[model samples]
Target: MNTTANHTSPPAPRVSKTRRRLPVLILAALLAAVPAHHALADKNDHIEARELLKRGEIVPLARILEVVQQRVPGDVIEVELEREDGLWEYKVKVLTPTGRVRKLYLDARNGVVLKIKDD
Candidate 1:
């Protein structure tokens, strides 16, 4: 007759409720924060644009386009306002007379070409 007792390792220590829930709580908080971040990014640009227009701090798009066209003599394809180095800038992408694409970075407050990049 077999008399040797079977050997089995003891079960692991049970985790406390808080310890088990900590990871879940952290994940939930992170998930909740993501949407807020996206919403703020989406809202800030439009809000700034509207405020600049309301306060006459930024020229109208038509004026910007006209100035850019005068300098580059091209078709304006895309325009965007961006903030860089605590300054507002307008970026314009144009297809020029020679069929070359150029990106023009303009000062948003006044129509000035900050940079021109070939694309």
Candidate 2:
């Protein structure tokens, strides 16, 4: 019986340095992406809405809606806040009772209608 413990040890598991660093590298990559994402998001939203609200730079959305309803009688279907040529405007789409879609652009600061378009 040649039971000499086989005179050999089991082969060692393969361990690539890259494999060991993969998780750490992935975490690092994710961490690096967060700040860049934030920067891009910030660029798109140049206005600090909360700060504007606190400083009264813009009127409340309810007031804007009221003004819109008074100017153009309809149920609001879509609303968008857009800053154009240094003007903060609310682009509102209203569905009138007569089944007409009217687009209204208003000054967000004082709830004044800027333009009206039939859609």
Q: Pick the TM-score winner.
A: 1
- Candidate 1 lDDT by residue in tens digits, 1-119: 99999999999999975586455434322222122224334434555566676787767666777778887876666566666676666777778879999988888788888888897
TM-score of each: 0.60, 0.59
Candidate 1's C-alpha lDDT? 0.65
lDDT of each: 0.65, 0.65
lDDT of 1 at 77: 62
Lowest lDDT block of 10, candidate 2: 28-37
RMSD of each: 18.3, 18.3
Q: Write the per-residue lDDT of candidate 2 for residues 4-112, one digit (tens) a residue.
A: 6756788989987557545543432222212222533443243455455568876766687778889988667666565667766777788888999999988878888
Clashing pairs in 2: none
